[model samples]
Target: MPEQKAADATPRRLPPGGGHRGGGWMNAGMPAERSMNFGPSARRLLGRLRPQRLHLVAVITLAVVSVALSVIGPKILGHATDIIFTGVIGRQLPAGSTAEQAVEGARAAGNDNFADMLARMDVVPGTGIDVAALARVLLLALALFLVASLLLWWQGWLLTGVVQRTVRRLRADVEDKINRLPLPYFDRQPRGELLSRVTNDIDNISQTLQQTLSQLLTSLLTVLGVVVMMFVISPLLAWVALVAVPLSVVVTQQIAKRSQRQFIAQWTHTGELNAQIEEAFTGHELVKVFGRQREVEAAFHAKNEELFRASYGAQFISGIIMPAMMFIGNLSYVVIAVVGGLRVASGTMSLGDVQAFIQYSRQFTQPLTQVAAMANLLQSGVASAERVFAVLDADEQTPDPAEPARVTRPRGRVAFEHVSFRYAPDTPLIEDLSLVAEPGHTVAIVGPTGAGKTTLVNLIMRFYELDAGRITLDGVDVTTLRRDDLRGRVGMVLQDTWLFNGTIRENIAYGRPDATEEEIMAATRATFVDRFVRSLPDGYDTVIDAEGSNVSAGEKQLITIARAFLAEPSLLILDEATSSVDTRTEVLLQRAMAALRSDRTSFVIAHRLSTIRDADLILMMEQGRIVEQGSHRDLLAARGAYHRLYQAQFSQPVADDATLEPASVAT
Candidate 1:
């Protein structure tokens, strides 16, 4: 192989979203290495919930009502405490004495402050505890709390529906984006990395929303409601309790800034590690064949370690916020308690009011702590959202023509007219190449690996648009036709056969879901699939596993051929289609293909020279250009590139007029 050819054949592994196809992995470093913009990612993630705005409003309204009711419960309980205290003091006074007499008695004892506090208590002298009033106040407090609990539960229920619906729409958008992305986008992205974005990252976003959204909303509302209630009970105590607000904000901000980066790194490493694991499992047999298990394990360990480090760093850094916030809150609580106690003792405030203030202080700090704890989850979720957004924002392939041309009576006469294309701008793969495959002709393309043989077929399918020229099917430009319209008339069988986890019959009928039983049987028989399928205990109903490990490689190939045959396309593409089958199976497939190609134009990419001896046209390509073209005998008579390739394969020279018989090529 030429140097360029060898380079093309080498498998290039890239980090997630590393480089474009022809640009190679060296063109740019790993995308995961870059730092994420936390603000924008978080905002965009919240935007996904916009569709559920009405539900969110309902949730917020419920939370506000619930928090308001909860706040009033503490105040109502404080009022009940005042009533009980007044009743106790009244019972202690002399029977039949007026409240003024009790206050004057305390003042006469040199306890003027106690007299002043007693004067404010509104106790009726000579009375026992007001049992009816106490019962009424307690009942009111209980009812308020019960209503609050019900409202809180309803709010949580609404928030759950909102979060799930938002995440569902996001998942749908990601799926649609993946389908619209160009083939080259997938080529640049590792299968595992892509899967992580679609599965793991999206799942993380869902979990983040589920865990944080309702709790954050409720916490914030509770904080606001508590502040107001504290002020109502005692403005001095409320101000003292709020001293921790700035400190808590500073702590959360500092910790979140550091942890967000680690969270991004953590998810990025997660994706990279998943890619390695997927690669290892998918190619375990290859690793064992080459005795590279140790190397594979080492690579896996390196990736795993990176993931562990990122996760540990993210957790450790974000973990500091809750404890730090709690410390500040505790300090504020102690100060407020001391101040409120002094005021109560000095007779400037009631004991019941001081008690309620303490309760409000605790309520204030608890939500702050809860919010601090949720910081980690929020950071992690936004990191995942950034990754999912990357997929949604990727550039898609050019859209099909607005007014698509139709192929009413298909004849499959594909023509490449001065077509020029490359995977990357700087590295040209095919330049100004042209070819014509007439209807009902079989064109065989033979070349060394990376000689643009596959690229030629890919162009006809319009998998990638031509950089400078146009291709046509039946004298109509393919670009003008809708991609679906063009592909529907074409059937392709690749070297690596793919079978979904389903029955063999379902796999055969994949290309034509509405295929009749007789039509399906005819296709299977024509492609030699029935011969082996009938031998299985389940016959056509035999199930192929996810990896298709249940059947032999040749059997898989036969099933794929049968699938293509069932489609009965006007244009057929067989790319090393018989390379996996045995010699006997190859002969049968060749005969079947010959019959299938009777009136349809077919392009066969093959390495075996014998396969193309009967082809209507033989193309010898080298370095993205056709070096020779003609019938096999004509190419041999010309003593050109085709002749040399044929001679090299057989290891024997041939005379100009020598007739080479077609023989089954061993896989």
Candidate 2:
């Protein structure tokens, strides 16, 4: 089997956001990574509310009261129906009965009054209006309705504050989790997919809590409240309404279960599409240079089409719930009406009772329809919650030692003693590797592609833990010291330059936030960054965009060099740091690096043989092992693997006179 470098050294296969589809967005398609469990995720999400339990209790209480007020209004209206019927029948009022007393007596008679009906009944000789009783009941109903609306509003207002706080904490947790995660996590996962979990997923949870959460509580109470009222009116009719419950459950469960998988697919495809878009846009210029625009568009179209299919399936399937529920509810309604009419006619129930029963039945089925309708959204919220929790629960980097050794001033002496590591457990990339670099020495690493040159640098920096190895700095084990302290003493400038949106001064001072203005200028001048910054309109204050697109790639590299200079590290690692600059700038950067490396140990990994020809030591690696180690002159004299590589990089091919094919360089 072919050898592979350490995991971090391997090229990332997925774009920044191109997450794996299995186990939804949370798992990111890694078989070793764990997907979130819904039950645990939900419990953790609700646990966030523990701090605001009192507020949540108040919100629930208010929701229940609001529904209760709305539920009882119909019953009160039924009483008024009886009053109007009695008044229209010309019932006479007793002598000396005041309007208020007559109204009370009318209510006591168990049949309520309507003000308009009572006024019209005055024309009959044996009848008189009972306006006071009708007005009292109507006013009470109106008051209850108004008060219930107020309660609903208040509950929503309180919930808004609570949900906002919950979302704030969630966002904070994700931000912190990003820092705790291992570098390997980001290598396999896209920044965009992780961002989707942090921003989009958390936002989804917030929306559900703000809007759907309150409605969920109200719908549940309405269903319960309506059920009790149904039984109270007539158990026979109640049984008929209850028939819709199981049927609704069966239909909703079947549809929701199918759509749930589709919902997961929809989000997974969404993450994939986002990752693709992010990669395409990030390297749009590369796409144009390589003439792969059509290919990119085709890939995007395929992912988009998949997204469309998943979205349509989830939505179309879930959409069936509302209408199916409505049909079931209507069927229950007809049965109740027919059966109830027979019972009323047979003196088993009153007209008012039947009227109340019909209203309660409508109330019962309405919430069922609502819950069924929101089934998709609820599942989406749960899925989002699961993804968010996955990040929170992901394994963090190895913790620092309990009693870490303090490095007061790291001396640059470094050593690797029988170090062995692999990208995967079974694939050995490095075995029994050993090397030593004394203080203030320049140790250059030279190797072909896939020779684990960068992997050696990663191991030295401890970006990845070794499978079996002991690396030491100044005779002290590097792992025994706190990572922050160990890393603070080392500085690196890589081929890929990273600069955030900020002023030139801010970007340079990023590693040393408290550096003084004079100190910054000194470092900038040392790295020749001051030469360019002086030409810019804002000098060092020029604001760069997120990608630093305003500056050329070489300029970005110069700025990163200046950043490392300001860091004043004891050990420096340059991984083809001058690959982007022109020959003139490269010469200047070499002089600056020589000056920087005078007192500090430096490790240079370069393909350009001329760059490392003057180094104190040179190590030639092949297939994850150091095949040759010596000074440039000694390697040149030995004529081994390093000699062949140096000759390939520097030697030109002879022209062939006989054949049409170009002559090949001698090995």
Candidate 3:
């Protein structure tokens, strides 16, 4: 009953030779090649944000204001210095004061006692300090500091909305894409890589986008404004600060290239690690059965180490970015301080001008630091963008003709002509196989494994395009008909019946939601699922967890059949319909199948000959070609491939028929 503990606690038994090796992987040393193909997906990635432009506007405004506040805060401090300090110049306060004495004298003139005294005293224009003016300037500086604080908070608040909404929408788009994509896309992609794009990449982008976009834009504005202000104060000092720009750009470009390459590898290795973990846990039964615990752990360790190396390498290169910008920024400040000091000492510049130059130099460097950090985020985001778009670029399974003339319902008569397919150019999996299932009849296909049996169904379902063939329903070419229309008509009961984690009623209702509860009960009763399900405390309302692990394989199979019965399609394709069930249950399923197929056309691929013993036609196939065709009794009498296979499957003298008679076996 507890398959997890029962399976894990025991030793693992792998299938011989090709299962798990000493390290739990048959090909443990498979070369690690995690290459990404990056191209013009940047524009496309930006378009993914179309729905959230309003949030972008709000975020950008905050960014601009926040940068202005921070950049001007120091500049205001510099201005305050000029207003408060009176230097020794040719212009002096009417000779009642020294340069230091003039500043002290002005401070006393600012207030009630001071202003009245200053107004009463004799002070000349351009040579005197006004204490009242200095106080007013200091008040303005205080207001600038307060504004800067508010801007930072505003930036944070605006960014929160952008990050949460954009990330939610982006995740939703990926999820929607997953549902829209044809099944074949999943066949080629590792689940781990796809998962990494959704979880890790999107999460990184959300955290970085609102903040980094703000930082980068604000930094650019600050740098430009400061550079202009620097020239206003002194062109020579501004030039010294500008010297690092070209070098920083070139170095950052190099870092972007290296980090991009490493990030691609990092995500790939992360995917491989996840894939290994999923495979290890899912097939843990196999691992433990063969006593492969040590080997499994060791394989996992190897994958983890590879991921660590790749991630460490990527972050290490990206990490250099901050220090590089800071190095240039610090040097720029020293140059400004030295040059401005020299100019002021030589009397070529006023003390106020020198102070302004230092302020502008800082303004130039701070934004540059912010921009450099933003560049790092940009590189990683771009890498993820490329990966996500790669998925979008892969050709979807083209739906059959769009806007085609409608056929309200399909009368299932399927024909395959000269059908051939090869997944790769050289490895032919299906050959020129011709087949037909007439309306209102069941055609059974039985052959050895890899005889193109499932491939036939896949082609019928249009999971993959055929290399050369024409498959038709009734008189219409299937490719010319809409895919959904065709799928809607055909009912499939896969070899592995998957029941999602929902109520038994919900699972059955998937095929037709409009079907009433009474219809669902009727379908279940028709398939005999009602027998076992009713035995439980809850009948149709009982929940099935993770493919109905609580129910036996036979019960799950019957529930799936009930779903098919509810769809009530004109055709049913059953692949290994009875393999997982016991002999008695198979008899029960066969009884249900008789009523299901009485009026509909059915194509069956079966290994259990008993279920298909009375089919109107049976096709015997080998190596992608059907070698025999006839009714079951007629084929058994012919002594050909069908005869041999039928005998081979049931050679044990029926294992005593009375015990296996299965009361009320229909047909």
Candidate 4:
């Protein structure tokens, strides 16, 4: 919670080059308010901007007109004041002045009469402030103001619509990439860290669009318009406004640099904190059983403290930007005031012009402050953008080939021909090992803890590519087939089955999205989960808590097995699949596995020797090699590695079942 703000705020600075792990060189750029630090790269945000072009064009057009009207409003008021002192009021009209001039003269007379009634009046020479003139000028200004407001409102509405659409696409794309990302990607990142990148980072960008972009755009346009007005009013004085520009720029650059560093730290710290929280929660049971509560708490406290410090540091630096800008803006106002007043007093510039100049100065500063405020958001947005871009930029594995050869759904004949593998370059997990599972065959893999039993299943699934060999299904190389197509034909019931936060029916239905309720129940009966499920309050509709925490471990396994049964894949994989429940559940799972394997190519890796005693081919693996292979009865007769392993597992007295955990139970 202490880091919530930083985690939520969206930092703009990222490790340069979107480093996969180690931080890299950072490019210097403005703090995030206006657009991305790099103008061209920032244009990417503008790509989405075009969708609201009509509304945005109206908004900008109104802004320009409003600024022009405000800049001239003061001049009109000053001119009317001066006119009261001229022939319109004090001086009689020249003998043959035109009738229109006479009418203006009459209006001035009325204004002077009203002015005299109100004692404090130093009128200028040509204000033209008669009732009709006054009404016309005020109405014009009001119209312009209303137009500006309407445009801004419309633009805001447009921005919200765009934010929702952009975030939706960004999140979906990131999630899809995560799913397809090579497994090596996960080896380099914590899951929590990647989650922060895809979720928190994208959310930050959305917040920026909602709150900060308007300020940035307005400030920029104001500065531009006011600069033109300043030049028209008084060339020499216009230079003074320009002077503040550079000063503001330099200070902003420094602020941006410091803030970027803090933001990067904040993001990094937030990711670390989330990582700690997830890890701690995942292992909470382990901590309690081992009585390590104090240790875990102390570690969490340390991470929490770091998170608070990082957040506070990031916020403090970003917060200073607005006030500093305001101070500089106020200083510019003072300079413009003094210089314009002197020009008017010397008669070098008209009073009306000086008045306009002063209004222009304030207009320029307001946007300057806006641009400044925008810097904070700009910084934060760029940070989020960079992270999001980094993910999109990741060198994804070579995509599946286009125009790949196609065949009907697989008939489940698998072969590994001289297949050799290693996770890292120097370490081999499997070497030159060839095996096959023709249809309707049960191949069981037995090995010591470090043996590559699981690796074989992964390769068969093509989760990792083969090295120095080829794997084929029905004589078609797996690599030649579409990844989804290949995997769809394979169904795996991994040891740690994950259940979504949904009902029993939904979870079973997930394996085959179109499965009917009757089919789901049939799967449940096949997997021996129906009796227990029927006893639950809502049967199949019962809501599971986070990670199926509401259910007992045995029950979760049964439901998971039922899901696999529902899938009815051509190739079935049991990767120590029953290693996390009681003996009763283990027996149910074995029966379920038996029923499902009847008409498929099943690859099961077994820990309990009893489970694989009837396997068609039992292979004993040591390190990465298959040292022996045969039927269970055949291996037992050979009395080699498989024989010794089987004897060691089963020779124990049945009494040891009380002390030893069941085959379905795991850490």
Q: Point to the candidate with the largest lDDT.
A: 1
Ranking by TM-score: 1, 2, 3, 4
Candidate models: Cα lDDT each: 0.84, 0.79, 0.70, 0.69
Off by over 4 Å in 4: 1-132, 407-409, 652-667
The digit string of per-residue lDDT tens for model 4 on 438-528 reads 8889999887765777777878777677778999998888888888888888887767768888888888888799988788889999887
- TM-score, every prediction: 0.93, 0.87, 0.83, 0.83
Question: Model 3: per-residue lDDT, tens digit, 1-667?
Answer: 1111121111233221112221223333444444444335455556666677887777667666766666666556665566544422314455645444544566666534333333333344346456677677778777877886787678677767766777787788778777668754564444555676678777776766766766766677778777777777678888898998887888887887787777776665565565567667767888899999898788778767766876787888977887998998888788778887776655466566678777777677777777777765666676666656555566666655656655545678899999987655666666887878888998998777656677777777776678898888886777877788878888988777889999899999889989987999899888888888889888778999984778898888888889999999877988877777888878877878878999999988887787898899998877677889999989989987776676556766565544331210110
Q: Which whole-number lDDT from 0 to 100 does residue 290 have in model 3?
A: 93
lDDT of 4 at 506: 89
lDDT of 2 by residue, 1-667 (tens): 0112322243434432343321122323322122355467667777887888899999999999999998888787766655565565445555555555555555677545333233323223235445777788788889998999999999999999999998998898889888778766765666556667787888888986776778789999989888887888799899989998999999998898788777777776666666677777877898899998887888778777877987899889999999999999999999999998777555476656788888888899888888888887877777778778778888888888999997666679999999998765666778999999999999998877767788888887777788888999988898898888888889989878889999999999999999999999999999989999899998998999999999999999999999999999999999889998999999988999999999989999888888998899999887688999999999999987787777666666446423211111121
TM-score, structure 1 vs. true: 0.93
TM-score of 3: 0.83
| Number of the predicted model whose TM-score against the real structure is largest | 1
- Which clashing pairs does model 3 show? 11-288, 11-289, 12-287, 12-288, 12-289, 12-290, 12-291, 13-289, 13-290
Candidate 4, residue 142: CA error in Å? 1.9
Please list all clashing residue pairs in model 1, or write none if there are none: none
Worst 10 residues of 1 by lDDT: 1-10
lDDT of 4 at 44: 73
